[model samples]
Target: MTYKQEQLSEEKVFKDPVHRYVHVRDRVIWDLIATPEFQRLRRIKQLGTTNLTFHGAEHSRFNHSLGVYEIVRRIISVFEDRPHWNKEERLLCLCAALLHDLGHGPFSHSFEKVFKLDHEIFTQKIITGDTEINRVLEKVEKGFSQKVADVIAKTYQDKLVVSLISSQIDADRMDYLIRDAYFTGVSYGHFDMERIMRVMRPMEDQVVIKSTGMHAVEDYIMSRYQMYWQVYFHPVTRSAEVILSKILHRAKDLFEADDFTFKLEPTHFLSFFRGDVRLEEYLKLDESIVYYYFQAWQDEDDVILKDLCERFMNRRLFKYVEFNPNLQMKDWMELYTLFQQADINPEYYLVVDSSSDLPYDFYRPGEEEERLPIHLLMPDRSLKELSRHSDIVEAISGKKRTDHKLYFPKDRIEALTDQSLKKKIITILYGQGEVEDVR
Candidate 1:
């Protein structure tokens, strides 16, 4: 069968918690799902390290990837019956959705920051490089793999198809928001996805929601905002992330130290420590392998590395206090000095984590990260910007909100021999004991 006509004898169905059932009809998609690269997602958590805070967040990328593919499949099926929709791009959209997140490494946020790596770069490589995924794409047709990668990169010529996969409101975000909420057991992520999809129309270069479905769309945006602060940006989740990033930084530094002997060879991290990780080497690294190294490092001679690993493994995350690092530069330095005197190593202990987002935005000229403003297709056959119509989104549109927190291991500081230092630190963290502890 030709790529356009390829199909499984019987459609394959995977019962999903978020999308009900993910049905796969194309042979290429079926084969791609069985590849080693795609299967690797099973070992990587969807929300890395969030499991330490919300224990139910143990879902893997594999689950979310499949959900994305199913969403795109359903969208394509609907688009097929509408005007301006092309049937030729059917398989292309599905494959792109399925493999978009294929190259994410273990604890990607920390690993990417420490190693200066980009999972998107590796994603394109896996699709275009010499891998099982590439081999399967080549079977469908030569050059099919690059087209899929370009869709994920948002550089593809078919803007409608690209928007369906990666635009501001696309299959990827829609799937994760719902899927993550389901696993995290949070109520903020609930929205009318079915109604939103019904109103989603394929425009010349983007997807626009019908005015009749404005409330559903509004709910989706609010859900995204709620999910961001309530679940994705939870302080406890950030606490685990703080320890994770420190562990990676400490390990990289220790690797550079003279005659550093690792009880367990960091076979997966050698190239990363040297700042040159090849695609093949990167594909070998996963959550399991990373955790194994952390377990081994707990027995290492480096106290920081050992302690950080213990903190991560034992769920002993750092406590955080709200602080504007820019305005409190002097306060930050004082804490740094205190940490050093207490032998806590401020470099790893005193961490400032920032989470920022513009709840909504209109297309602005010459901006770095420009998001296409949400457009509502009015009954008069004219388009209106979302913020102009919705007061809720307007109040927050183009207004960037940022939250800063100073993270430190309270237990370590409290263990200091000097009672005065502990009292000062407590005062700095919470003046007059505002709360018993930082959750």
Candidate 2:
């Protein structure tokens, strides 16, 4: 029998913390899940360095990936009964959802930022290249893997299928919001996901929510906004990411230097440092391997690499104060020189991190990340765009909110022998009399 025609004799169910039961009936999905490539996700954290802040956010990408698959499965099951839905695209949606984050490497954001790589590109490679995922997809049908990859790449002909995985309010966002909130033990991501699923309707080109489900959709948007600020963009997590990026940058600089000695060589990172990372070399890295290197770098000859590694692994993270480069350029420059005068490499020790979010947006005619706006199917059979009708969603729609923070090691300044310099730094950070240590 063709792999596409295969099914388990009995459905396999995974007990998930968020979705409860991730039911798998397709033999292809079961086989794909057990493959080494997919299983590697077990070692990658869903929220890298978030565990340091929320102690409970120790969940792996494998956990969130399965939850995404389950959400797609449930959504597709309902879509199967709809008139406009193409039942042939069912498995493809499931595969795309399950593997959308397949190529996320260890500490994804920082690693990608350093390496100048996109996880989406790697995801396409994993699905369409000479790998286990590709082989399983091939057995299903000729070029089946390409179809799945196209869905993830948002280049498929069937816009409805593409919407299932990549649209404004699709399975990927739905699952991650709830899953991250669950792991991080925060209540911000809770929206009526089940009700939203019930209200979803397949359209000629995309999925739309029932007008009656406006409140639920509003809640989902709000949840996303809240989670972005309170959880995903948490200052502490960004501080850790800053250190991680600096460590990679420091290691690469030392590797390129004329006379640099190292106690522990970064075997997996050499290809990356050379700007020629192969897929095999990339796959070999996970958080565990990263931690191993951090432990070794602590004893390295380069003090900067050793310090950044120790800060990342030992929870001695840099602290931050709010700063806007637009209005506080002088403050930043002052702090920059003060840190240098204190014998700290301001480049590694001082960082300005910015995060922005647009809660919901209508489709722009020609924008870069051109997101298709969410449509609500009216009871009278008319279609209306979301923000136009929902006050809560409209208030934040197309309004890009940005946050900026300046990260530095306050501990070093506090420990300075020159109390006057320390006081100057503190005064510059806060105000004349405002001085309190932030860890």
Candidate 3:
């Protein structure tokens, strides 16, 4: 039995702040988005804790999926008559780009950290499992769903298809860098995307930028760097994550001791706490359901649960300062002991935040996860690795930057009943004086 491709009478469009309008021409793509599993993405925030820092970033992955599909569609439109560009690969690329993040769970990073679940696994399930997305893919062909999954999994033998969605400069990154920047209301996303698209040429196995468009590529690389530092790695976001991780830890502890009762459903959380989670149960969990529990736990008998929930809900983010992991180990221990003495839980109050990213890594022999380095098409029709041709990419290539921040609740510290313990903790956290930014 074969499913017929059904199109809406009038083309359906989603009004997006980033892409303006995402057009759905194919019935399969439209049906995939309408599925309950896909619709759940609308409830999950794209930037998670970033909403507390940038109020405008209240968008969701559903918006991003559409944006990615549009970008890939535009790319495919440009390469329709070009050599080495297969028209048959069009739908596969579009579907892969649109569903690249389909597996992302609620509060993605925090949920992953607590449950030890990888979103990529869920993404494959959504595409191949007994879901509407699978039904839609099967409409294209019997094994079309697996092909789509392969593209996202980066195991598709067609390097061209894989490069379109998973490469360093693929539609996924191209869309998110711009979408995230636009929603966060930052200027760093102002790269010449039109120019980049214009210069993109499909090769035998990959997409290469025209040498004439080298500057645009450089601008893109720099924009990504700035966005990472300015938005993606913001200390405030990490602070919120730290608080959330501790909340999950405390909740698990309480559940184990039977020391607390949940007023709402923690169905998804129970399996995670017990180290066993089924895929179907995992699918039922979303950010809204998790947040509902947080709201209800606000009035719980456990003081720790109540405080953490209040902190997360009210945007009372933890205060952060530069930290030296080795040098501060002693100070950290002392601070923990001091918190115990002051009746404050050091386990929740003290946290170390760290983030690292490789701006532009060039291909090297025998490296784990060898990146397919970006290439520039020379006028002579030869390809050159971007780092070899661009001084800027060369300078930043293989260079990884890391930031460490010590996070604590400054508000509670200032109100400490034990003056001596407070003084010690203050000295350890902020170095021997009244903390300046104690909010």
RMSD of each: 1.4, 1.4, 2.0
Worst 10 residues of 3 by lDDT: 430-439
> Where does candidate 3 stray beyond 4 Å?
1-10, 432-439
Clash pairs of candidate 3?
none
State residue 294's C-alpha deviation in candidate 3, in Å.
Answer: 0.5
lDDT of 1 by residue, 1-439 (tens): 5865778889899998888899988888899999999999999899998888788999999999999999888887767767888888889989999999998999877678878888898999999998999999988888999999999888999898888888778899899999999999999998988888888888888888899989987888899999999888888888888899999888888789887878787888999999988888989999999889888889998889999999999888888778886788888888788788888899999998999877778999789877888899999979999999998888778888899888888889878889898877777778522432434
Candidate 3 per-residue lDDT, tens place, 1-439, comes to 2234456679988887767788887777887788888888898888988888788999898888888999898889889899999988988888898888999989998889876888888899888988888888887888999999988888898999999998878888888899999989999876988789889999988999999999999999999999999998888878888888888888888888855677664666888889787767777888888888888889888898899999999988788778878677887788888878877888888787789888788887798788889999999998999999999999999999988888888888889877877777777766733333523
Over 4 Å off in model 2, which ranges? 432-439
Q: What TM-score would candidate 2 get against the native?
A: 0.97
Provide the lDDT at 305 for model 2: 88
Worst ten in a row by lDDT for model 1: 430-439
Q: Cα deviation of 78 in candidate 3 (Å)?
A: 1.0
Off by over 4 Å in 1: 432-439
